[model samples]
Target: MTTRTPQELAVPVRGGDLAVTRWPGEGPAVIALHGITGNSLSFGAVAEQLGDIDLYAPDLRGRAHSAGLPAPYGIPAHVEDVLTVLDHLGLRQALLLGHSLGAFTTAVAAARHPDRFPRVVLVDGGLGFPIPGGADIDEVIESVIGPAMRRLRTTFPDADAYRALFREHPAFTAHWGPHIQAYVDRDLTGEPPEIRSSCVLDAIRADGAGPIGDPETLAAIHRPEVRGTMLWAERGVMNEPQGLYDEGRLAAGDLSPDRITTRRVDDTNHYTILFAKDATAAIAEAVRTELKEM
Candidate 1:
């Protein structure tokens, strides 16, 4: 359909390349990191909401056209990759906006190198999840995000399927109908059937559980300069409200609120919050507020 991020730059990192799209505007640069199984388009709606601001959204390694990134997906590696891109671009500081798994990655980066990013926003994730014992990463995925992933796979045999699928989601039903539709439209290809989706199934699987890395490692990181904020879907299946309530209290004992903030997006769920109009507006406001404050 329409390409909002046209200035695409391929930056090589560790094991693969990141397909980064830069949109120039006044103000400090903003880096948008998509969730697992997602690409730069994940921030499409939110980007528009931010208006005239320098934006950089990257297709993380191994996802979509950014294939062949290093395996064993972990936060440290992903953060380093982003650093390489920043250095290559000569950006001294940036505002990081990450969703789902990408949120966790941004947390690691901000915590590890606070100087790299002065402001950060996590859109539904970073607090981590609670799974059953003896559960492998695959099992966790199947139990949590698999339904949406599979639904996307089956619904998008064509362009209409993507729109139809988003329409069906309880979270995005009343959101940016056109923008979400456009983001999904970008994946369209082939004739006869015209299927779409740039997501790499294997990459989704590999990058699954590694973002959690080690709690001890996360605790040890202290980035005083980084001011962080989180936007969580109230009805998220993964980091359910009750769970985050508990995790937040615990994280507070270790992490400072001045450094991190978490706000719940009401009437939204994990799958739909990013596209939901009101939710996206809230997300944009949160990011803008954080950046302005910083």
Candidate 2:
């Protein structure tokens, strides 16, 4: 692993251009995807630990620098952007790593273009949770990512105020530091005393109606040819006692254990599992170990 510095990039997408953070490395090429409402820096903590691979993380359309990207935002659109990014870089293949909503995107991309991604690493998301019978998918999407959606709609009086919003969040408060600070600052736009998240509410809402628990997501984790590791947090998004998935839930999910190996990251929540130092180190190790195994 080497220094993980942000090298900004802008690649054309459907509606407009998409911004990317290219962290150069001498080893393999890694295309990382951040969670919904999160910018590319979400992988800052973990990328810093892996000094060997070329890491490319994009601000998916409708978030951060890509927020201006137009309508028709959803998993399908995201998949197109990911492929476009690869083509723009002339990368025939690359290792895939995604967090939260990004994880879901990674899975589908890998499934659709296995030749482009031999394997992928999913952190805190990727698997589709079964929606209740007769439940409105829109409402369920709202419940799943409501806080992030709300924050996108919120207005902060100042940059400090914007940072305060995350400071109060249980996931980052305990692990706050420079990297987290960078991540927070990158998500803000507008002027001082009028700051707010860069994420677009419409884009997020459209993606919520995306392939959550859909056949695409399930195929990513259940296909016999699919291979990767799923790093789950012990705690939930709010840092609660239970997380999105547990041993029992995983066992009952009808996953292809032989294909996707699953493990729990102790004392971590959905956010920390990808950004916190220890958790990020674990993620770095997972990527490295798999590289060696492959």
Candidate 3:
């Protein structure tokens, strides 16, 4: 893989500046969005594989460098921040690629604006999961996220300490590499003895309940103008047998085959899917193919 240096810039948002990372390329521009707890660097591995395309990733409010931004943080706030990025970059429209929570935000952005994004590629998210009625939001998040949510409450002494903690995660143990290490390193902030993930728990909780629970987001999946592909990891977040969207769940979702194409990526989980070489290659190819069709 070719090594590319990413340029970091701060774009003005409502309350503060939004940090963005741009991987320069000559091909058509692609805007990449990371998961709820993830920073812009979460797209680093995939961006490396997509050498022909210019990639822009932002640290959404309440995560990483953008953590200080005031909230009311949720899908709508993220959508507005994304539009600010698009305007800052002078892009009238760009191909959108979002992973996990980012995928939910992408769908909402496409539906609300319709003209800002020409194509959207949802990576391991976007389709609403089945949350039993009357289930507590906190419990739902705990069940779905498991250890990740627990880590948010703990503080690590340093980046190495944080990295060691993640190394123990089942989904990443086998595939742990420099890319994942760098991603984890960049996610940590604050001085030693107080260092922890930059993601704000409150913001995550709000975002979890907002887009995933919104009926309009599901309806956006069927919008004719909001066309894209949904990529599903065969494994779940913890490398479990069942993924976020299993075959049965996908078949029952509101997604129309004519609007969105769904494909399963083998041997990947929610977090590792974008980091895997084969999965990243497939994602990049899908973006290129969609851009051509447009």
Candidate 4:
């Protein structure tokens, strides 16, 4: 159970460099994608459990260290970025695992480039989210992301102050361990009184609004060529009872049973589904099983 340190590398893209964090291993490679406000380090816990599978997670353009990159930010742009990462690593194909917004990106990538990703795993996302009727995209983002959206506009006096804010979040208060701390710490940049999250608000807006709002992009999950599983969290953001994918929603039959399978991880929220020990173990086991089949 020793955790391996991730090696930070930069891959060239059309706009600029894409910052990647790699956990080296020997088995089939797995490319991970983080959430809207997340960075490559978001996969730290999952990587710790994946003993023999190589994992490459990138900070999508306009997030974390890749924040400097320009946009055309949306699902299509993110899909191309994933392709660039695969090409840069000389990988013909890899298992795709995406959490939250990353899940949306994963589905698009799998559909757009079936040869590049044979199997996909979505952690707490990828399924289309329900936007209440008459709500604008900004309202939807505000309601869904809540404090995270507010944090993007606020400047913390210091990194500790920023951590304090997240520490207060119901989702992280119990599961806030080393991995989560490291992920949050890496999210902050600049000096005191000016320190802010590395995620660019404009990029998040485009990414958050585009995939969830697009009918065609969300339909990618049902594509016959795209095979995948979705691991859902029982709790929603802030540890609320309403998760992103509720029982009713799952039973609603939006996803094709022939292409995608869904499973729920209990006692975890959206954020912890990929970071909590038991939850990460489940994700790791699912990943190992998928690789074995491949």
**Structural similarity to truth (TM-score) of each candidate:** 0.80, 0.94, 0.96, 0.96
lDDT of each: 0.67, 0.82, 0.86, 0.87
lDDT of model 3 at position 16: 94
What is the C-alpha lDDT profile of model 3 across 179-240, one tens digit per residue? 88878887898889888988898898988886446677656666777788899999998999
Per-residue accuracy of model 2 over 1-294 as CA lDDT, tens digit each:
345567999998787889999888788888999987788999888888888688999999998889899888887788899999999999888788989889888888888888887788989888876665667755676576546666877788899988888888877789888888888998899997779898887787677655455666656667655578899999988787888889998888777876788889998898888776678888988888666645
Candidate 2: count of backbone clashes, pairs at least 3 residues apart or interchain: 4
Question: How do the candidates rank by lDDT, highest first?
Answer: 4, 3, 2, 1
Once superposed on the true structure, which residue ranges of model 3 sit more than 4 Å away at CA?
none
Taking every candidate in turn, the Cα RMSD to the unseen true structure, in Å, is: 4.0, 1.8, 1.3, 1.4
How far is 200's C-alpha from truth in model 3 (Å)? Answer: 1.1
Candidate 3 local Cα displacement, residue 293, angstroms: 2.7
lDDT of 3 at 277: 88
- Clashing pairs in model 4, backbone N/Cα/C closer than 3 A: none
Cα lDDT of model 3 overall? 0.86
What shift in Å separates residue 202 of candidate 1 from its native position after superposition? Answer: 3.1
* 1-294: candidate 1 lDDT, tens digit per residue: 123454778887776577787766676788888877677777776766777777888888766566556565555667888898899788887888888878777877887777887678887766653444567766667666646567435524556666676566544565646666756555444443646455656667656655434562344223565577877777754434442334555466465676677677777777566766687789878888878866
Worst 10 residues of 2 by lDDT: 209-218
Model 1 spans with C-alpha error above 4 angstroms: 1-6, 68-72, 130-133, 149-157, 187-196, 211-213, 216-226, 237-255
